[model samples]
Target: MRNARRVILCLGLALAASEPLATLATPAEAFAAQPQVYVVRPGDTLWGIAAHFLKNPWDWPLLWRRNPAIHNPNLIYPGDRIVLRYDAAGVPQLQVIQLRPKMTVSPIPSYHTGVMLPFLGSPGLIAKRSDYERLPYIAAADDSDTIFSNGNRLYVKQLGNLAPGTLLRVVRAGPQLVRPSDRKPLGHALIDLGTAKVLHDGALAEIEITNAREEITLGDRLVPETPVPEPHFFPSSPAHPIQGHIVGSLSNFPEMMVGQVVVVDQGSDAGLVPGNVLQIDGPESVTRDAVTGEHLTLPGRDVGSLMLFRVLPEVSFAVITVAKRGIRVGDALRSPPPEAPKVLGIAP
Candidate 1:
C-alpha cells in the first residue's frame, strides 16, 4: 500500500509541471504566425487597398497608428507593400509596412485663384440709388427710344460725385448666373457716358440710358469693375469628395421651388470639376444630459449628395439628387469615398 501511494503522488506532480509548459507553448506558437503582405498596384488608392482587408474604409485613420511613415493619410501611392496580421481569433488587421519609391513621389502644385461672393436672393433686384462706385456691374441695352433707353447709354444711380470717363461694368441677371457660369455675370461690357446731367443733389453725372441691345432697363444697378485674375479654373475632385460650406443661394426662378440655387465655396481651384459628385453633410444633434445640464454636439452625418453640373472660376453648381432631410444653405459639400472593401470591424 505504501509503494502504490508513492507512485500516485509522483504522477500528479508530473501532470502539474507539464500543464504549465503546454499553456506557454500555445501563445508562443501564436506569436510566431507570419503576417500576410500585399503589394499595391497602379491606380490603387489607400482607401481601396484598405478595403481589401478591412470591412470599413472610414477606419483608415487607424492605420496611422501602425505605420509612422504615412504622414499624410490621403497620400498613398502605387507599389506600396502593406502587411495584414491576424489575431488569435483569426481577425485581420492592416498596417502599411513599406512604401515603394514610386509611391512616395510628390504631386504637382496647382494654382488657387478665384473670387468669393455672398449669398444673393433669387430674382433679387439691383435697386437704383445704391452706391456702385469702384464696384463691378453688368450692362444691358434698352429697347425703347427714351433717353438712355438704348443699351449704349450709362444709367448709374450709385456713382456719387464721380467724374466722367470712369470705367464701369454692365451685367444682366438671368439663369446663366446660377447655372453653368456659377454667378459669374456673363457678357462683361465697359460703360462710356455720352452726356452729363444734374441730379437732386446738384451732382454733375452722365446718366444717358441707351438701348443698344434693346434689353437695358431703368432699374439696372451700375458699379465699378475689376478684372478676373489669370489661371482661373476649378479644383479637381478628390478620389473621395467630402462636404464643404454653402455660401449662397438662388431662389428666384419658378422651377427652383425648393430654393435650389445654393452656391458653395468649393470650385475648380479647389480640385472640383463638372460632373463630380459630392456628399452633403450637416451637424448632428445629441441628447442633452438633464442632470448635468450639458449639451453635446453629435458627429456630422451624411444628409444628401450633390452632382456638379456646372463649374466657374471660383464657384460650382450642383443639383441635389438624394436628401434624407432638406438641404439648407451653408451646408458643407464633400466628395464621397470610392467603392471599395471596408475593414471588417472599425469605429466610424
Candidate 2:
C-alpha cells in the first residue's frame, strides 16, 4: 500500500503583513548562534539543502525525522523559507515556511528504498556491482532462451529443497581488480539485477523473475534477500585518513555531477565508514613552461565531495553531494580534516 503523505501545520513566529521579511542567517554555526532562516532557492533539493545546513547530505533522512513540521519534504518549492531551530538538548528541527506557490520536485522513495534499491539495482537504478558464487547461478531459461526479464521462467542450480514462493535476488560477478599496494584482490564487484521467486523445489529450482532492472543473462548468480545491510548511518568526516580511487560509476553518463553515485576502492577494511566525506580530485593538468620549454604537471584540486554510504569488504559506494565540475572515473579520493571546507565552488 502506498503510504499516506505526511502533513504538519507549523506553530511559530508571526509577522505583520506590512513588515519586511527578516534576513536569514546561514553561518555554519547558525544553529548554535541563533535561529537560521533559509529561503529556498532555485535548483534546491532536500538532499542539497541538508548538506548546506548540516554538512551531511545523506542525513536528510534524519532531518526528516527531526522536522515533523515540514510534511512532504519534496513538496518544498523554490522561494519557500526553511527555519532551523534547536532545543535545550541541542536537537535541531527544520520548519518550512510556505510563502510562495507550492511546487514539488523529483520523488524519492522512503529511506530504505532510496539506499538499497540503487546499490542492488532493484527496479529503479542501474546495476553497480555483481557478486559471483559457485552455487545458485542461473542454469537455463524455461524455453531455452539466453536472456530473461520480469515474469520469465528460469531454472537455477544449487537451491536445494527450497520451499515454493521463496524469493531470490539476482546478481552477477562484474570484474576483479587488484589493489595497487600489495597486489591483493579487491572483492568482486557485485551487480544486483532484480529478483525472482521459486515455483518448484529440488537440488535445482524453478523460478520466475518478478522484476528485472536489467537483463538477466545465463550465469548470473542468485542470493537470498534479507541481510541487505542497514541503510542509515550517521554522517561525519572520516575519523582517520582514507585514500582510494574512483573505481567506477553506475550512472552510465560519461560525465557525472552532484547526486551521482560513485564506487570507491576504499571500504571498512581501509577505515572507511558510512557518511565519511571524501574530497574528489580530478586528473592532473599538464601545462607547458613557456620560458623553460619544460612540462609542468599540476596536481588535481578538490573538484567535489562525496559521502561513503554502502560499505563492502573492499569497496564502498558514495554519492557526490558537491561538485565544482564533472566527476570522472580514476579521480583520487582523500579524507578531509575535521572542520575543513567541503563544498568546492558551490556556495553554502
Q: Could you tell me every candidate's TM-score relative to the true structure? A: 0.34, 0.65
Q: Whole-model lDDT, candidate 2?
A: 0.61
Poorest stretch of ten by lDDT in candidate 2: 13-22
lDDT of 1 by residue, 271-326 (tens): 77654556677766787777997987776787765545455555665555446677
Worst 10 residues of 1 by lDDT: 7-16
Q: What tens digits encode model 2's per-residue C-alpha lDDT throughout 1-348?
A: 122232333222211111001223343333344335767665444444545454434334444554566544545555566675544554334556664334444332212244345474332122334324554878887577788998898778888887789878887655554555566666555566788899997866789999887789998887776445434343456767788888777655877887667778878888877667788888789999999979999998978788776777687887776778899878888876444222211112
Q: What are the clash counts of all predictions, listed in order?
A: 56, 6
- The lDDT for every candidate, in the order shown, is 0.40, 0.61
What is residue 295's positional error in candidate 2, in angstroms?
Answer: 1.8
Where model 2 places Cα greater than 4 Å from the true spot, the runs are 1-49, 52-82, 85-112, 118-133, 227-230, 251-257, 337-348
